[model samples]
Target chain A: MKLLSIKFTNIEEEWKYEKIELFDLTLLVGVSGVGKTQILKSIHTLKEIAGGQSVNGIKWELEFQTLKGNKYLWLGEFETINSANELNPEFFIELGDLKEPKIISEQIFLNDKIIIDRNSEKFQFNGNEMPKLNSTESAIHILKEEHLIKDIYENFNLIILRDHTFKIVDLFDLNQYRIEKLKNQFKTFEEIKKSDLNTFHKLVLIYDVSKSAFEEIKSRFIEVFPQVENIRVAHNVINEHSNFDLETSLIQIKEKNVQKWIPHHKMSSGMFRTLLHTAEMYLWNEGTVILIDEFENGLGLNCIDVLTEDLIYENNKIQFIATSHHPYIINKIPYDYWKIVTRKGGIIKAFDAKDFDLGKSHHDRFMNLINHPFYKQGIS
Target chain B: MNLYFILKGEKTEVLLYPKWINYIIPHYKQVFLEKDVIENNFYIFSGGGIPSIYNHTINAIKNINDNPVFDKLIVCLDGEDIGIEERLQEIKKHIENSKVVLNPKCKIEFVIQNICIETWFLGNRKIVKKVPEGLMLREFIAHYNVNTNDPEELKKI
Candidate 1:
């Protein structure tokens, strides 16, 4: 499924009043401090909230449409955005114009026929007066009994949509450690322990074939270092119980490896960032929305053109919302995808590059002018 | 002379060098491709990727890269206490089949000796500390700002 458009409010300078369109392959362009990453962060926030997960201090209104005729609206008034005492003001999704979404046609279902739709919670349509919904009778549950919405929860899962369609897939991206952690959370450790030889031996015979398929997909993207040929992933080990836990992360390998005493930090900064791009591509394969804060950290002008042609233009699956001050990454993508985020007062304002211009794409012209804007302030 | 300028830039300029030499262009030249793109005579670190486009550095380094017009290739570098010529040795020797050295030449190469005098004249100023007395002129060149690409920026002795 494709995303049509997004409405964002109360976000970073580049994301406020953000109305962004998507392409089969969208390129976010701009130099550093322009706020491309902020847009990505906001969208990821909205998707996370939709999945019944919430982050504090995220005060605002946002909405999105799916290929299915479902319009999900999330609105809330929290006492405090950060603390656990934070309350959800409202949560509901409008299913497609599927008739009788709730069993309120003057009947609640009994086996098959509707017994009563009366006393349903807050009825409104074509101007019907407010009526109390029966406390004992949940109209939503009645609709579910009739198979009105088959995949209700799965369809409403914002994370699943972001991961499956936009981010790609999450299951394939998980390694052995994550796989075991998810299994251990099952409570029955004896049944789920894959690392144990006894468990692995029998399971290997039964599901070893399917396991190979998973490994085959995982192995395709891994880069092997020539020195020790050791494979290293970049994601930090996150404790789920901890306040900041993430399921996926990026990985990197040396650009050129040989046997020599070398400090880990001494590698060229530009080549080191290649690891981030590679891991990001893998997540794109799994459908993950990546928000890169600085896209041009260690890069030089020498590798600019290849970075555009190879990374930005080549990858089609993942959605990248990154902020960069370097023209190398920005010029590769089109102006429509490039957003200009300017900070006015204390608020952030994000705009499409093309909005500031007519007809032509903003790639070259914006790069020339905005690449170095002589700000209203005297000092750069 | 096959003269090349390894410019640090994103801007474009016209060639102020000769045309007979072969030019090996580096990437990021900002020009589109044309015929006769690869040249054996010129080795350019910043090729615009297109063969037909004219480049000052590309034309300068052509044919003359091997000729003896330069007499000696004098290396100018910053005095950040970092060994500049030592780092450039591999690259320099690879380009021209001669050993590269950092030395004093009073005419066009006087930038080094000038740096020597400048350090003795202005050292111990505010944040700048003076180098050891008689810190050979070649070593003093490291104390001055030397433009890697623009020869005109060099202190003309």
Candidate 2:
């Protein structure tokens, strides 16, 4: 599933519902304190909720489409009670666009059929009347109880949202869990090779070492660091005690000499960041949504070029939403992919860069619009 | 010819230079290839104020000499209570005493606006009559153009 657009309000007292349309590669750029990071954080929170966390008191109207060419529009409104931790959510889901959008009604549909309808205190689902649901819980929270809408619920679960975190200090500090996952994938490949069920096994190939994703990531990493000769998963022998196993597959770099392979911790900040980004970009499962705040944290101009190009043309399977403050990155990206954010009276707002009609040469026009705010600030 | 300019005023110079620069400096060949207004080949750098204009001019000359992109360096500044000859001599001495050598092929010229940049606008009798006395002409200069090249017309006001 791909998120097409979103409209949200009541965030930090911003009275208007700001709508942001996303593309394959969407980037948010603005001055500091303009709520660029806050937008990413809100999306990350929603993604976590979609992954089964209790929904919070943040109102949002979202539209997404599945791979099977089905569109779903959902509006969610949540209210906070006496305690800060408590939430009261009301959801409205529609299968497709209708002539009159039911803005003030609680409705849920599956394939153009009404599955759930809640009016004030009365609740009905699939023509059967049910007891009044708790005001503080979402209707989706009790989807298992019905059991009739299993396929629809499973389709909703397919929406994967992943937040990629980056910190300068932890750039090279390899996560143990990621290393173990890689080793397990390799072990799975070995197990499949040893099996002799030729008829069923020929139908599918679970994992092939030659087609390992690590090789592709290595090529991308080398593009950023041409001096990097090779990159591979190796075991770090500290005084010759431990062996190459699941807990640690240290990313080793061979630069000038094949004999001297520098481990992950020994890599520079720029090198480590480029390698980690390359690995994460290719490793994420297809159709996954990723949110990255300040994507060009430690990258140089050339590295940013490679990354933005990859985001624009290379990675179609994964959808990206990133925030950046660099003009070099902003100018290179197509203007249609930009969401220019701004703040006023402590309230933040965002609008698509294309809305300003920045002529054909978007880079020059974008700069002209941003530098002279009086010309475009009235857009919101 | 390739050229770099250093202007020592605020919006008055920034706004007026783009429209009037081609007529002000004669060293650049007037190659108005298109009828529509297009960006000039010359580069303009703001020197902040009168004093900084002198320092910025020298730095720009040295920078062009090091990289050798421009063939000429034109620095424009305001007389600002001092005579035009004194400011010219001050720049001449610095160019002669500099350890970093200037590019021999590159020629440097200094253009001093009498009193200040605003006085150039006041030089025009038509503009002086339109705005009230003692009012800043910064906003008025936004409509500046290349109409006349008469130095005597500019000197009368």
- By DockQ, who's the top model here? 2
lDDT of 2 by residue, A1-380 (tens): 57787776543244433777778788887767677777766665554444345443366766666656566655555542233222522223232521211112245555566676665456677778888655444455556445654433444453433333434334222344343343354455444333332211211223234356556767777878888898766543232444533233456789975579887767776677666556556554455567777877778776788887878887787788888877678778887888778766545667777775533221143443443443235333
Candidate 1 positional error at A169, Å: 23
Candidate 1 lDDT tens digits, B12-128: 211311121224333222211111123322212222311211132223233223332322222222222223444344334443443332222211220122222233324434433
Candidate 1 lDDT, A142-179, residue by residue in tens: 23333432222233332221121222122123344343
What is candidate 1's DockQ? 0.03
Most TM-score-accurate candidate: 2
Alpha carbon lDDT of each predicted model: 0.36, 0.58
- Worst 10-residue lDDT window for candidate 1 chain A reads A160-169
- Per prediction, the TM-score for chain B is 0.22, 0.67
Q: Which stretches of candidate 1 lie over 4 Å from their true place?
A: A1-3, A11-18, A22-37, A53-63, A67-288, A297-317, A358-366, A371-380, B1-157
